[model samples]
Every structure is written in structure tokens, then in C-alpha cells.
Target: MMGVKQFPEFRSERLLDYLSTAVMVLDDHFRLMYLNPAGEVLLATSASHARGKAIRELIINADMLTEHLSAAMENGYVINQRNCRLELPDLHSLIVNCTHTPITLPGQRNGTMLELRKVEHHLRIAQEEQLITQQEATHALLRGLAHEIKNPLGGLRGAAQLLEQEIADAALKEYTRIIIGEADRLQNLMDRMLGPNDIPNMRGTNIHTILERVRELVRVEADSGLRIHQDYDPSLPELHADPDMLVQAILNIVRNAAQALEGEGEIVLRTRVQRQFNIGNRLHRLVACIQVIDNGPGIDEQLREKIFFPMITTRSDGTGLGLSIAQSLISRHQGLIECSSKPGETVFTILMPLDSKNES
Candidate 1:
């Protein structure tokens, strides 16, 4: 043991211990090989205690997870995202979004290293980065489209009116009516698209109040057979938002949920605190999360990812702009909207950050 040089193992340990993020290094087996301090925080545990334990048992089923890593490892390098359902030992289920990116080291053969970062965290960061770019792009397009669209709309309406007066055929009038009606529809759409880019300053207001208003409106329109419930957190403070925009956002989601229920099912509006929430790729101090859930034939899987995009809808007569408008409004207020659907259940969640620095 004479002149035994110090290995970098201790130095590597120190590096993992101090890093702000949880970095776990797994071998080709997807085992719990090494968990840094930040990684332990993410899992609600410490590194010292999680050693040598099979990763599968610590969290929920890791079968889907192993595939993400294996695919990444087999390829040169891959970045994969997984929705991990973490069933903690306490019998509570917490869903975390995780990313598995392959890590290859020099002279390492068939390497597999997985990095798991919370989805909400990563999403917020992504949203932040994408917001300005998306806004600029959307704004430029909206402005240009509005001008281009409004001009054609006027010409169509004028031409339709002239045809109605000149053409003696009653059936010909039907064709003009269709053109005129479509022009008005396009005008309405342009209003929704370009009307609110500049508005009054946003204010701080009660979220439950907005939700209650939306619920009451829906319940008024709803039939006697339908049931609407409120499951709200009374302790949540007022959020910084535009009252009109907030109302519109809540109404769109609630209305969508109620319509899905179709007047004979249960629609629940729930409010809960997402202890540490992120939005627009930034970790907000605290967030107000409201879920509009319905028991009905759920949204189709193929349409889930595209639901927030403009002009996407499930209804035959729907404008396909409700969700898009609501999303734009919430985005202006620095909030987020997400939807999940399965058999007999669909949930639309909106997360809005609170303004108060100190707890009230």
C-alpha cells in the first residue's frame, strides 16, 4: 500500500453531494447505481439511504422507464421523456415528468445513464423560452392575417350583397347568403384573434370567485339531470390576473368539461395547491391549480397533444378557438393549461401563480 495515490472517487462523491440538481448515474441495468443529493430531494429521500436498492421498487413500476433508458443506450445518444407515476411508500401517488438522456463516457462500452428532471420544472423553462418567440410569431401572423383577411371579407360581403340584388334566382340568393355568412364568421374570428393584444393592466383577484361564476353560468344552462360540484381550497390567496381573461379561461374549460358530460354526468371544479409549481419554464413561488374534471366519454388520445393549438376542437359546430383563446389569455397572465383524459374521466387543469411574496 506504499505510495498509494488518492483516487478521484471521493472527489466525485463531493461533486454529487453539493450540486443543486439531482443527478443519478445508472448502469446498463437501470439500477439505482448512484443518486446525487439533488436527485434524493426530487425523490423525497436521501442518497445515503437509497443506495443499492433496485430503482423499480423505490418508485412505481419502472418497466416503461427501462425502455426509455435502453432505447437511449442502444442508439448513439437519445433524449426521452417519461411520465413517471411515483407511488411513494406513504401510499400517495405523485406524478413526476422525467427525462432520460443517454450519457456516454470515454472508453465506456454500451453505456446507459439516465437523467430525471421534473416535468413541470422543465416545462416552465421551456415555456419561458418559447413564450416570446411564440408570441412574436403569433402576433406577426395575426396582424398580417387580420389585414389580409379583413380586406377579402369586405369584398366578399359587398359582392354577396350585389349578387343578392342583381340575381333573380332564389336559389342563387342562397349562394350569396353563404358567402356573406362566412365573411361575418371570419370577421368574428379576427376579432378573437387580434382584439386583445393590448389591454388594461392585469389585476389581483380571487380565483374561486371566477370559478364560481363559471360554474353558476354552466349550471344555469345545464339541465336538471346534471350535477356540478365545487371542491376548492378556501385558503388560497387572490392571484394576479386579468379578471375578464381569467373568467374567460375558466368558462372555456368549465364549458368544455360540462359539454363533455352532456348534461347527465358529474362535473367537478377542484382547487388545490401545487406546493412547488412551475410555469413557462420558470419555477413560480406558489401556484393556484384549478381542475375542471368531468365523468364522460373522455377525449380521444390522438387529439390530447393538439388540444391547445388554435382551431382544434372535438365538437361538430365548435369554433375550435375557445381553448386557443383561453390559452392565450392565461399565457398573458403567466399561467399554464394542461389536459389529461382517459376512459370515463377528463381533467383540464389551469395553474396560476400567486403575487404575494409573504404568506397571508
Candidate 2:
């Protein structure tokens, strides 16, 4: 008989390396022994640099995490936490569901295995799907309504024009003129409500070019005190999108930020590239992230939920169609816009896929 074929043993570290959830191993003394790639991403540090560092040094506010790790190691208890907040070194915050498991071998020292799964990512994906669905339904309804309304509107305008030509008295013709003018204004408003109907003229475009166009426009129109700052990733690749549509989308967001700032606060336009990002149901290898951050009074909690819906406005004189139209434009480019606000800061983030392929 032929000799039995032998296969090399699979290493646990190799398995951990492929995991999507962040995994970190610590020695009994709570010193970092190993960090998987996902863990390195979560902590924003490399395994080579982070090895042997104290957990406290890696995470700024790790008191709660420390307590759980200590319990798991000291009592051999497994601990799981949901919606735990982790503050990173760069001041970015993460909400995660984490698990702590104690490990012991026959002759090896005690250790702990920690796993972190980001909660916000999952939540954001759900929200994005819902938003897309809601917008699609709203747009369909509006299209049907527009068809019904526009037919009568055209007839009314035509009737008014005929009356204007037939009227002998100048004063009575003024009524016909008002009727025609008001009909035209309503038609324009309806068109605005419907947003862009033309198919996006897509091509390879630099995101910075679109942002700069928006910046210059806002700067020219804004007050002297309104400052716009740029924090862009210079290495971002060209995106496949419509340059004009992107300009309009970003301009709407920046203009909204300026209006919120009331011409006296700072608005920062920041860009970055995210890898292995999910938008709606598709996963892209690379996605461009654009953020319009403003230091102004935040949006109301109630309004924030419906802020993207048409006709939802916080300002007395505001039309509330700007953001809705912006959302529509970006959606056409396979992107999403999300907003978060507090008392002094509001951020509008737009995520756009860089390529057509959906990577697995």
C-alpha cells in the first residue's frame, strides 16, 4: 500500500488572520502577545509595533475592558459585552460587541483571547438599506403624482395664456398674467421636488476637482467669517462618476453646512479612502469617504430622523429640498450620505464606491 499522504498542520494564528472580527491575545500579565490584522485595523496600529504594549497604552479609556479581561483570566470566566464603547488613540470612538475568553494549555501560561466586532458598521448598513428603499418608494410616488399634476397645470397655463390674449381690459389681463406666472412657479417647484431626471454622465473623475469647485462657489457666496478647510487624502484614486452631479451633490451639502453655521463657523471638507466597505448590500474593495463637518449648532433629534425627506425643514425660510436633492444625486452614483450631529458639531459623510466590481 502506498504511504499515507500527510498534510501540514494548520496554525491557529493563520486562521485568526483571516477572521473579519478583530482578535487580540494577551499574556497573563495583560501584555499584548499578538494582534491579528483585523485587530490592528481596529486599534489603528500594526502588530509589530503593538506587541508587548500594555492594553491601557493601546486603548485610552480601557478601564471597563480591563475589568472584563481581568475577570476572564482570574476566574476562567467568559465575558461578553454588547454595545461597548472603545476610545481609540486618535480620539475616534467605536461601538463594539466584544468577547473575552480565558485560555490555558497543559504546560503553557494563562492567556486571554479578545474579539471585537464593530456594531456601528452593521447598524449603518441596515440604515442605508432602509434609506434606499424609502427613497425609491418616495420617488415612485412623486413621479406618479407629478404626471397627474402636470397635465392639469399645462392646461391651466394654456387657458390663462389664451385669456390674456383675448382680454381687452389691461386690468383683467393682469389676473391672467398672475395665473400663468403662478402656474409656472408651481411647475418649477414640482420639478425641483422630483430632482435630477437625466442619467448621470459618468466618467473617470477626481473627487478633489469636484470638491474644489464646490469650495470656490461657497467661498465666493459666503461671508468673510465662514471658513472652509480641506483635509484630503492626496493618494485617493479617481472615482467612476459624473463630475457635474458630484459637484452639485457636494455643493448642496457644503451649502447646507454654511447655512447651519450662519456664516460665522468653520466647515471642514475631509476625504479618505476606506477598504472592504459595504454600501447597501454590495461590498466594494475601496470606497471614497467625503465628510463635510461644521462647527455649528446641531440638528434637533426629532428632525434628524426625517431630515432627508422632502419638505422637512428646520429653518423658517428654508425650502428643505437641497439635502433631499443631494441625496438623490449621490444615490444615482451608487453612494450614500449620512449625517451625525451634536451640540457644537455636525458631520455629513458621503460614501461612494471606487469601482464597478463588487468584491467578495
Query: What TM-score do all the candidates reach, one by one?
Result: 0.63, 0.81
Candidate 1 clashing pairs, residues 3+ apart or interchain: 22-38, 22-39, 124-280, 124-281, 124-282, 125-281, 128-280
Cα RMSD to native, each candidate?
A: 10.9, 6.0
Question: Tens digit of lDDT per residue, candidate 1, span 1-360?
Answer: 432334655666576555545677666666676787667767777777876676776676667777777888787666656567666655666556556667765567454556666655665567556754565576567668888888878888998898899999999889999998988988888887664676845677888888888988988998887898989999988787778888887898888877887788999889987644456544544688889899989988889766766668879988777887787787777676877899789998887777433332
Candidate 1 accuracy as lDDT: 0.74
**Candidate 2 error regions (>4 Å):** 1-18, 26-34, 52-57, 60-79, 83-93, 101-112, 278-284, 314-317, 356-360
lDDT of 2 at 247: 92
The TM-score of candidate 2 is: 0.81
Model 1 residue 254 distance off true place after TM-score fit, in angstroms? 1.0
Off by over 4 Å in 1: 1-87, 93-143, 155-182, 198-201, 356-360
Deviation in angstroms for 87 in model 2? 4.9
Lowest lDDT block of 10, candidate 2: 1-10
Question: After best superposition, candidate 2 residue 37: deviation in angstroms?
Answer: 2.5
Clashing pairs in 2: none
